[model samples]
Target: MEVVSEDIPVVIAFTPNYFVPVATCISSVLRNADEDARFHFICLLTEALPEHMQQLLNELVGELGRFTFMDLTGTLSADIYVDPKYTIAASYRLLLPDLLPQYDKVLYIDCDMIFRNDLSELYHRVDLDDNYMAGVFEATLEQQLAHMQVIGCAPGTYINSGLLLMNLKKLREDGMVAKFLEAATQEGLEFPDQDVINQLCKGRIIGLPPFWNSIRTFLLPQYKADFLRFYTEQDWQTVQRKGNVHYTGPKPWKTFTVAFDLWWRYYFKLPKPMQALLIIPTKLSLLAKIYQTFLGKTILDGTRALYRKLKRNEG
Candidate 1:
């Protein structure tokens, strides 16, 4: 079926390497959405997808929703600084206003996430009357304040770009795309695209509730202090209420975590052959992590014993 203008347009950007996870993401969204819900996915690609993968994506999109694959290779200028940690796809969201000018608004979601709630609620309920975009605030006030300073924006304006609701008309009218690209070229940002979005949008962004873009902060103990430093009890409760889960740290596919099962529940829905190919690398990666941890522990234990013996001899 053709995607009508009335249907919500959701955008995701990723390289060919993340095809499975992106497929899983779309599958999860389809599973959670209402039967009558309509969505048009705009997949901005940094590289060409494999034939098998393209077939898989087509099968998934069949009759459920509409999708458009956009090749963004060689679109960005050489001067734009891309973080080594991320692919060029990470910056693709910056081009939406220019590439998709027909749409008034579009939702940009990261491939490393799963949808647990109906997206229609988010699409229709949030009012972007005067803002360029909407997103959940970053988890930490300190980080928010720091980034705000970096962009010279006020406090409480920093937001995560992982799941963004962009007002395309407003963005284009304000010339934010050029501004963001200019900032990217000049600044040494840790998260280049995200920093540019938060910096440029500033007070123009509407703060969505935490439920909309809940990062998996509760899963890691090391992050607890930072999480608590920013999020309140109510914020944690919102996360529990089942919104979009951003698998930020170690992806569930690569290792076992609190949310690994949740991710696998959707992964198993894929074709059996795909399951076989995907699980092997994930299991091997887990084993590799375990082996590295054990080796480091043994080396530390041996060093500690030698240090104690030396201390005793000195005594």
Candidate 2:
């Protein structure tokens, strides 16, 4: 193993269709990083990333540190049950211990988020010596009961897998890959890899404040009561001050919200022409909202059903 260096190794996994948000995510990090921050990015993908995108990534990370891309096509087991909403790319983070043996620890974040402050604090300050990984709690104790039962984890320990400070050395020593594979084969796993991680690393996960991976819903009046009960007052202040926003439910390009506005603030940093192309989803979402408001979901569902039936008949 190489000597543990000060440079942070940050990992992200995404598909081709998510390039816009990927770029935006990276941009937020590069732009907001502290002056002394140094990073090494490892992007995992299943398909061959286009050269232009690779070049753009290089340009984005220029002089900051290295930006490496690994195509992980066919890397996951065929038997691993991937949820319909997620692709095989979702499991690519599981390969980190093997793929990045040189690094003792690494930060893995989803591409659907943007940083509000320098990540140096997270990469340097968090102690993962005794734990396999550290992450923020994803739900209230009541809400986590079902997931905890599914994964056999204790209450308040179930974490959102979106942002993680992974102790790769510990995971490698524990042979986590095999354990993950075994858990992947288990029945009644709703969250696929997330369940596997929680089940395998139970009682070993260090819980961070929710600010680090603040979902937009936490800011809503309906959820804030539960959010406050689940987390500390400092956590709420940290999120309010400056923390990365995770677009867990609705993406910014497809909907408008305080969190989406934060996303747009960073996204607009890209060239004007490309920005135009990215807002198409927002336009379509607006149109859908208008259609639903006037005609209702019943009409929309019936229309979709009729369209699908017609297509099937034509086929």
Candidate 3:
């Protein structure tokens, strides 16, 4: 392979239940990255990964880069709030500064996403300055403003923590790790770790373009106004070409979800022998095309109703 880029350290955190998703995530990165791009993945696990899975991950990387797993089974505090859709391991990202003391900068990506292009540009080009971390803003600011304000974060600055360009050196120097853990465990903090980061890192966080974390919510036709309210036409156009699809709610694995086929392509590329571990039920595949149309429409209708209700209460 030709070498043209510097080594970029990427961090990902997951639990035993997310092994297949993590595998797909890694596969996408390796498959889509530039031929010259080099990466070293440091994955944080909530428990000891099975030996066979570890070997499979190693094989997945092959000569493209390195894959290292850090088992953190007993280190986390149990009090952190965990959403029903996610596992307790989601909060593990807060420990990155302490966990990887060697790197001043690292890219943290959630396992539920897939890359459309090489990450070298995003990794090497972002300027963090004195900020603790940088990430794309979550879409639909109007609907989310009240909730953001309740958490003490400025409406426009609240970002989705899924994809982050972290300045570990600054985070460590400012003692943000301890602060993050403390805030994560606090009661009534919606989104747990994400709320803590926004609440505490206010004024010190950087917001990147939407393509880095393009959530499924952006595609809802009912939210056209909301989408334009937060991002420019140019931003939307760019995302269409290069967005790293984030499967936020209703993951492709378990439900009929938009962009499921994009994810399926990457999973299908994984070693044929190991592909069986990640197969979806035959019923889901057979019915996916039939329900694809209504699934999105239903979600939009429900979201519109909720938006109207929120507007009435605010009025």
Candidate 4:
């Protein structure tokens, strides 16, 4: 049966395998909404996702009933055409034209993000003067060059695609999809999608801030940057009180161990018990991801060593 749900206005994302918890972006937006109905969270995929990822995302979606699943491969919607490449988020830009009519505006965020505060400001943040479609801001040029080098593009001129506040109508009018495909094939363009978009939307873009498109904070980088702490720390207890949140990487779900628990605590205080239960394990799974990350592995190893020590003490 066709799922004839009401059309919504808000953010959108195209993720496969449920590998990343993009919920951190939606969670804060939903929680901080005074209107409660201002936006919706649309999840686009070719098939049904894992039941476990669905559970947490469902909890995050809350009563807004804002979460949705799209089987693009099953449908002839002609809406989304994402090339499954790790480069420039090819699949995401494909979601533009088809997604435009669904919402007046939408913010697309990578799953590696954690919301430290409300981000509703992004909803209607488009700059119409230039007919510019979407806006993303970064903190440092060094970081920008780093991101460029990641997807194989040259240094000094790359933009991150982790978080986007898009004006869908503008994107469609610009024929953004065809433009992207053409740009992707352009010679000397190494960072397929990111480089194409930066050149396509270049001056027309409305510059926001570093926090908006905080990039490369999650993955392994040549070195660490401090701006990351601005988004992820949960308790704010440590001297290094978490400020930065990762935008993409294996360490994604791990932020929950620090932040999601605090988020759930506040969720329970304001919401109900059942709702809280629905959210807690999401934290575990995300945090469990630390087993593969540097910090997670180091912590887990220390934990095991401590456990053995305690057993030896007791013996």
- Per-model C-alpha lDDT, please? 0.77, 0.78, 0.80, 0.50
Comparing 2 with 3 on lDDT, the higher-scoring candidate is 3
The number of residue pairs in model 4 that clash at the backbone is 10
> How many steric overlaps does candidate 2 have?
0
Note the residue pairs that clash in candidate 3: none
Per-residue CA lDDT of candidate 1, range 1-315, in tens?
244866789899988778889988988888988877878988899877667776777777788777788877899999889988888888889888989977889899999988898887788889999899899876564545665676675654568789999999998998888998888886478789988887678778888877778777643334556656566667666676675788877887776444555676677777765555564475644543443455844664566558757876897
lDDT of 3 by residue, 1-315 (tens): 222236789899988778888989988888778888878888888888889988888888888888778888878877777767567777888998998887889999999998897787888888998998899877645667788778877656787888999999999999999999887887766688888888888888788888888888665444556777778888887776678899987888787565666776677677875676766788765554443467754774566669867886897
How many angstroms is residue 225 displaced in model 1 relative to the true structure, after the best TM-score fit? 6.3
By summed lDDT, the worst window of 10 consecutive residues in model 1 runs over 284-293
RMSD of 4: 9.1
Q: Which residue segments of model 3 deviate by more than 4 Å?
A: 1-5, 287-315
**Residue 195 lDDT, candidate 2, scale 0-100:** 81
Q: Which ten residues in a row have the lowest lDDT in candidate 2?
A: 285-294
Candidate 3: residue 127 Cα off by (Å): 1.7
Model 4, global lDDT? 0.50
TM-score of 4: 0.59
Error of 1 at 22 (Å): 0.4
TM-score of every prediction relative to native? 0.83, 0.84, 0.87, 0.59
Clashing pairs in 4: 82-91, 228-244, 229-243, 229-244, 230-243, 230-244, 231-243, 231-244, 233-242, 253-286
Tens-digit lDDT string for candidate 2 (238-314): 78778688887878677544454567667768655444445466575554454434364456556656875787689
